[model samples]
Target: MTVVSSVKDLEALTLTIVNEFDAGVDRVWQLWEDPRQLERWWGPPTWPATFTDFDFTVGGEARYHMTGPEGEKAHGWWRFLAIGRPASLEIEDGFADANGEPDLSQPSGRMRVSVEDLGGGRTRMTIASHNDTVEQLQELIEMGMEEGMKEALGQIDAMLAE
Candidate 1:
């Protein structure tokens, strides 16, 4: 189990997930660089994700959908704000409508992902999700974001092994 821990801070209005993988930073970074690898672990096992459009560059966008066990779909989109190769990435993430457009009515989160080389062929990944308000943060938590993220991240270990 590579997922180390998850912490939610109401005062900071952020959720952070830390994971340590038994692979090099570059190898682990490929999970985000390659759409196929990304799709394999972007969502929980029960709700596998499928990326329709993925542009892993600054100022680019990514559109994906997670299909639930009952065949229901949850659409989402990401607007890349910054990218620093295998080290870090910053993006604005939000829910999208069936038409693949962002739903302004819903709250969006600013996410920063950082990958650090831990030596010994190990990498430590940190995902920090920041919300605009505590209420919004609570809303997402109530919606099971923590568990979903933990489950989603748990899949990465297997992907990296292969």
Candidate 2:
């Protein structure tokens, strides 16, 4: 997501996050698309994530079971849309059970990710997710999406640095 602010109204806001990692584009891409590598940085670093039946591609699905700080389990899935190796990927995210069947009505919306080489063995990663309506955006906010993503991305950055 790129950050944009409305000059007309200070209350109108948009999220724009730009992060560069100390890793090559291909390496970062591989880490993102691979289930095993994803496990290393999919959720909060302290909690760790476990994946099941992960397939990264158009029409493919991925299931991740994350253990919370209190040891509670929650599962989620991603339905792939576009996949361009070492460049970009688009997908839909949602909550799911152990079987990877998502509730279509309560999804997290479509997310588009772009990866670019930033020279010096660095890769820039950008992610944007647009909900279907303002209601959904509010729902996402209630669900703590922003905080979760910050934690997730923070873990990713740590993995890339390592």
- Which candidate gets the maximum TM-score versus the true structure? 1
lDDT of each: 0.84, 0.70
Model 2 whole-model lDDT (C-alpha atoms): 0.70
Candidate 1 clashing pairs?
none
| lDDT per residue (tens digit) for residues 1-162 in model 2 | 223221221132224345678889998888778888888866656456788778876898887777666676666778898899889988887767646567566746677778899799877887666565666566445334435676789999999999
Error of 1 at 93 (Å): 0.2
lDDT of 1 at 68: 72
Local accuracy of candidate 1 as per-residue lDDT tens digits, 8-106: 887777889999999999999898889899988777676678989998888999998887766877788889999998999898988788888888898
Candidate 2 — which residues are off by over 4 angstroms? 1-14, 98-100, 133-162
> RMSD to native for every prediction?
8.6, 9.1
The TM-scores, one per candidate, come to 0.79, 0.68
State candidate 2's TM-score: 0.68
